[model samples]
Target: MAATYKAPLRDIRFVLHDVLDVSRISRLPGYEDATPDIFDAVLEEAAKMCENELFPLNRPGDEEGCTFENGVVRTPRGFKEAYATFIEGGWTALATHPEYGGQGLPKTLNFVVEEMICSANLAFGMYPGLSAGAYNAIAAHASDELKARYLPKLSDGTWSGTMCLTEPHCGTDLGLIRTKAVPADDGSFRITGTKIFISAGEHDLTENIIHLVLAKLPDAPEGTRGISLFLVPKFIPDANGAPAERNGVACGAIEHKMGIKASATCVLNFDDAVGWMVGKPHRGLQAMFTMMNVARLAVGMQGLGIGEAAYQGAVAYALDRTSGRALTGTKYPDRSADPIVVHPDVRRNLMTMRALNEGARALSYWIGTEIDVSHHHPDPAVRQEADDLVQLMTPIIKAFLTDLGFDNANRGVQIYGGHGYIREHGMEQYVRDARITQLYEGTNGIQAMDLVGRKLSAGMGRLLRRFFHPADAYIAAKKSDPALKELIGPFAKAFQRLQQATAGLAQKAMANPDEAGAAASPYLRMFALVALAFMWAKMAEVATVKIAAGEDVDFHQRKLKTARFFMEQVLPEHLAAFAVAMAGAKTVMAMADDEF
Candidate 1:
């Protein structure tokens, strides 16, 4: 059976307009024209492209994968055509600067569209997704000349880009990289190195590929400090800024991956490639972070996207497949057996997937709004606070969302039983594709460590107040309301546990750092749960008021029910997480080095 996709535009609009009130983004200088009508049209058209063009290619893309012949990558059938359609629709420049042939829309809108793309086609989305990150990096850190050279093409989708960071010897440890860069007579550098696991590294979709590579220059310091960022294109441009001659970069080969097979993960070898520095020499890591931070959020969306796709498939299957009758009675008296949707177990799985997907979506969009405020807010204090919140939540979003996305994919497979195991159903492909989101863009473990080790203590825990104060304020405001008591009670309890755990981990980590390391993963999970609970509470508050006004009663009621299910069924896991975090690191460290 072919995989199906609907953009969930209703929920998307609800989260954007009803929950987050994204119109406020228009107050920022560049977003004044981001009216509701424009947002609706953009989303409606994006939905058409994603559902009509991309979703159908997902199964075939995974089945056929990418083909590499003599250093050339051919994306699965329909990929190039779909990509052309995507670019032609002006989707690529949706959130970019107007000066660079872009629409100058808010980044929040870009993220909303991105989620639809990822849901429709995870692998194919990488081509433009990588380009967006690369554009961000150059726009932020590169010189005016470099920006003028690269930004226009990247924004317009005439060309694509890649971030070259990892080598064969070093994955996360950038200090261990052995790539070398040497200065030439005309001020450009000659870059030579082999970068592995480069997504969108080499492809036939574009005329040129701009690679943001990390290499070490002569006389540079040791370790990560020695690394420098270089803008090395596949074909060095002529004076007119068009591909003039072939540079020394070439695709060595592509990886044989477990999933996202349609995305070409290449091993790129730069043999003294002509390149120019992107930022101050030896400050490449900081410069690259301009890309990494956005990339992490994009990866989080990938998780949410795959989970949503899986949930939809599972729900469709559950509604159609028949098995034993319902526990109480026959749901379909006219049929031989009731559909699986009538069963409690099936409902449980579907609801879990649905709740997580929706809650995560709300939380992500809220974060996206924060990102816009961080970048564009008029008040310095407001921007700083929003930045702090983004810093604190990025890891939680990346790790917890991806982890649950994988779990949701599995639940989707479980709901399908044996048919899910077969390739034709496409549930298993979701599982495979979601698996990578947790591993790459800083593994979930690294994200947890960053959360517990750096972000929690940053600014002497002041950054945490970005999340805590709002949550506290919401609980205080809603605690006394009769209709909101159930939601507030659970959320308040989880919030309290989160506070205690935060303080406890701070003390324990101070005494022994391993306690932080040991507790990191569970603590991040707990943090994410509390964050989702907060979003649910906020969403329920809006839904309740709307219900009272007799506006879209069914939608508002379902919102309340989903919030109730999340609070009742899922939020209690914070208790276990809190307990595990408080356990310290002794048991984990006590095991012998080779005991396994």
Candidate 2:
């Protein structure tokens, strides 16, 4: 099997520097040290760690997977070592707050590192990924005592974490949870329940595992309002805060999954485990959202990661694998058959992958920097704007990027033809791996619903304003640029369609909520396409100005080409999406109840 991965450092830098200008993030109080030189140095080191330490282990990890026996779960070979190297390099503490012993780098840099890690080994990334989410939840909601005890360990990677939200029967519907937490004598609670699909649930990468669990209190009301968050460690800390007595939270079994096999997905049984409450009682979902929102963004990076890897693999195979000559003529007359790169169809797949990957990277990286801005900006209004942007883009990033991730992975397999179907070239694995991303962090359908139902209407459309205002300004600014007519024209028109769809859906949704539900998916796609169009137009603008200035000519030229592809070929899909979204609920609900 020839599954391969290389961190796209140049593209990452382009997004960080040229597109988003992350120096704006560094201007915030805590991120002053996040200079371009520091970013390059950190990214270069991260690329090395990903390429050398982790990428080689990806195939082997997939092959070996994880093993479970006698209440112990062991990660595949090299994972423990790779993880040691990861934490020893302070990778675990990259974006954590300095109060918790982290270096407290801006999340912009951390997001880039995260993408590289996912590209290298997604399974390996999960171990720390979950821990980071747990850290966020705890930092925001946990008591000072709990934070003092747990935050340092989680930040230092001496311990890892998991978000145990799902059970056998309930996942998205947290209101139906059966997990119960009883008040204990020692001011803690007893968490007794079974949680399934728990990623990194029982991995052996770290000394101790902390589980941020969702369970209902004895006196709590029914439904989601009754839910409470608990911190249940796999090993209870001793008086000195080291792993001591075993906690009742044990891995009953691990799930056999389609992908990310090396990342242990466990069926955990908490047998009256002593745990402490986090946040206010009956406010678990609010606190957990702190984790879920960040996880959603991180999952978007997973999609980007897979897309980049799959695209790279397809490009590699296309360049190496000889096939029929070009339709026009043979460019390489000496060879009996030209490489597949000479073919138009092959170029289409390659171009789609490249254009989407680059555009998505630019968009995601922009939001990543905004995360830093939202948290650290001195001005209240600027912070609010950044936060609004993050909220609005979260679902789009999660759903749109993952959809492309799966699409591009399949495209890789398509490009490989027969070789792709089998395990030999590893294109098949990309498909399998990409599949899970859309399913988790809320299904893309659910994401679309969140966009239409929640984010669309939140703060009286303030979230929508965050995206709409800048887009309005950009289109107005560039619509008249004759040199940019090819790029900006397509983007401006598509963006108009998006605005129309937005208003139409909001009006229809006000009349009947089901109209929103019916149009949610297409509306999200329309919004996403327009968003990407905006990014492409911005990139095209930069490429145009930079090319005219004779700076980084090759990179700018390639950027212009990809931007043109996105604007001309890709952004137009919003028209069809807009058509579908505006048609509205009646036809969709016409066949209901017992038609089947």
Backbone clashes in each candidate structure, one number apiece? 0, 0
What overall lDDT goes with each candidate model?
0.93, 0.91
Task: Please identify model 1 stretches exceeding 4 Å from their true place.
Answer: none
> 263-382 in candidate 1: lDDT tens per residue?
999999999899999999999999999999999999999999998999999999999899999989988998899999988889999999999999999999999999999999889999
Error of 2 at 143 (Å): 0.8
TM-score of 2: 0.99
Ten-residue segment with the worst summed lDDT in candidate 1? 1-10
Candidate 2 residue-wise lDDT, 1-596, digit = tens: 27678888877877788878877777898889988889999999999999999998887888889999998999999999999999999999999988999999988898889888888888899999999999999999999999999999999998999999999998899999999999988899999999999999997889999999999998989999999999999999999999999999888998888999899999999999999999999999999999999999999999999999999999999888898889998878888899999998999999999999998999999999889989999999999999999999999999999999999999999999999998767888889888999999799999999999999899999999999999999988888899788887888788788888888888999999999999999999999888888888888887888899999899889998888888877787888888899998899999868985
Q: Which has the greatest lDDT?
A: 1
Off by over 4 Å in 2: none
